[model samples]
Target: MPGRSHSGGVIRRLAPLALMPAGAFAVHQLRYWLAFAGRTGLLLQQQGHAYLHSVVPWIVLLAAIAVGVFLQALGRAFGGQCSLPRQTVSFGALWLICAASLVAIYIAQEFLEGLFVTGHPAGLAGIFGYGGWWSIPAAAAVGLVLAVSFHGAHRVLHAVADRRARPAVRVRGPARARAPRHVPAPALAPLADGWSGRGPPR
Candidate 1:
């Protein structure tokens, strides 16, 4: 319970910070796809392509959830009673780490984009243009949402597992009848030469 309490507290405190990263990632991806579609006419030119591209963000989000579930299962199998809290902390940490990594990559991409300016560019600059300093906050928001969603899903899974594990059959037979079978004691052999039952063997 203490571990659960501590983990819950930490997640609550870090939720807002975590959301920034998740949101940033989501927005960045969304913008990238929209721009790509507009420039290439891929969405309009190809049947079903627009719809498929539109679902990319959802697919990515679901993948994140899958990762969370996998982590939760792993923790439960390995950590027993402390599984939930351990899983929650692990999921939160995963989001935080992912956000940090993306932020680093974004910065590097921005720098590279700036360095490679040319007259006949292929829109790499536009694709990597600075989306303002606000992307950091957006990324954090996304991460926060991911962590909270993972926690909620984890709790739901635990509840479902607990419900499914309840005993289905209850014993109600008579107590004496239900008692384990007992073997009768063997009849004692006739004592030798009038020896008493309490005395040691002759």
Candidate 2:
């Protein structure tokens, strides 16, 4: 596991994130069903009912994982095994991107679910009960345009950053132009008795 990488197992790796919520749901439902299976109803009488709301995000979590896995697979299968960005984004930008992506995926999911039966199946789609078709296409178009704009801005800013990172010519005043002067060393003092009191011997 020390040198392991997620790339080696694409779909196999995504399985956990994508299936966790479903698995949790299955277990939760199974517990309830089993509780009703007997007259005791011990499982249903269990506490922690307050935490039931916590499971609501499982669908959204699954959707986010699905989107990430799909994109990663797409990049690898054709885009040369692309990996996630190692750099961080601004807090606001990150929040906005995450919220927007989840909304998009949720909408698309609802649309797909509307098309097929109440069961599971591979698919794709979008939905809009109000504002007609205009709103649907408009949302998609706006998202696309924003994505393009963000990419362009990122590239331009990246180039500007690279340019500014290079060493620059810093001008200094005349007073500070010369190199620093060194301090003079202290002179040696006269020797005591032996050398000072007598002359040198042959």
Candidate 3:
């Protein structure tokens, strides 16, 4: 299992897909908890509305999942040559990518909302000018957390797969063929010539 430690079947590869959304949801909850520590009821209620009211969070989740799947596909095509430095760089790039994508999507959503309310949509700078820049750092922070979660989950899954793939140890020794249970005594032979049943020759 030298080279195959990181490699696995379909299930092992696809298992991490669920972690992407779970990480996103966990971060959202943490944000809610921090923002509304006193109002437990409102905080609990917001969880449902979070996804129902807006498409932004769902879109971000989908985008993250898509990126994860793409990376897994790439890992499969090439081998799982994920060294420590390589994974760090990869996830770091992922953090930047997710942050950029999330910010862009949020801006687009804001633009659409503005266009719906007012006839004209706000210009790009106007969108960023009016307190919209905050989204950048927030998204980047969330993206960083998600990237770390993904990396950790991947390592755990591969470790489990490697353990399961190992060959079982043998306990009993090799079997040997059985010897005959009983042996017959040699038959009595006749005496020298001219001797019958008597002890000595006639």
Q: What is each predicted model's overall lDDT from 0 to 1? A: 0.52, 0.45, 0.54
By TM-score rank, best first, the candidates go 3, 1, 2
Q: List pairs with backbone clashes in candidate 2.
A: none
- Which 10 successive residues of model 2 have the least lDDT summed? 124-133
Clashes per candidate (backbone, < 3 Å): 20, 0, 0
| lDDT ranking, high to low | 3, 1, 2
> Candidate 2: where is the Cα deviation over 4 Å?
1-15, 34-46, 79-202
The clash tally of candidate 1 reads: 20
Provide the RMSD of all predictions against the true structure, rounded to 1 decimal. Answer: 14.0, 15.5, 9.9
Over the stretch 126-199, how does candidate 2's per-residue lDDT look in tens digits?
A: 23332123333433443444444444434444444445555678987677567888989785556832356567
lDDT of 3 by residue, 61-175 (tens): 7666656664664454344333322244577787787666656656665566445544323566434543446556666777787677667656654554455556669898889
Candidate 1 has an lDDT of 0.52
- Prediction 2 global C-alpha lDDT: 0.45
- Measured by TM-score, the strongest candidate is 3
- Which TM-score value belongs to model 2? 0.26
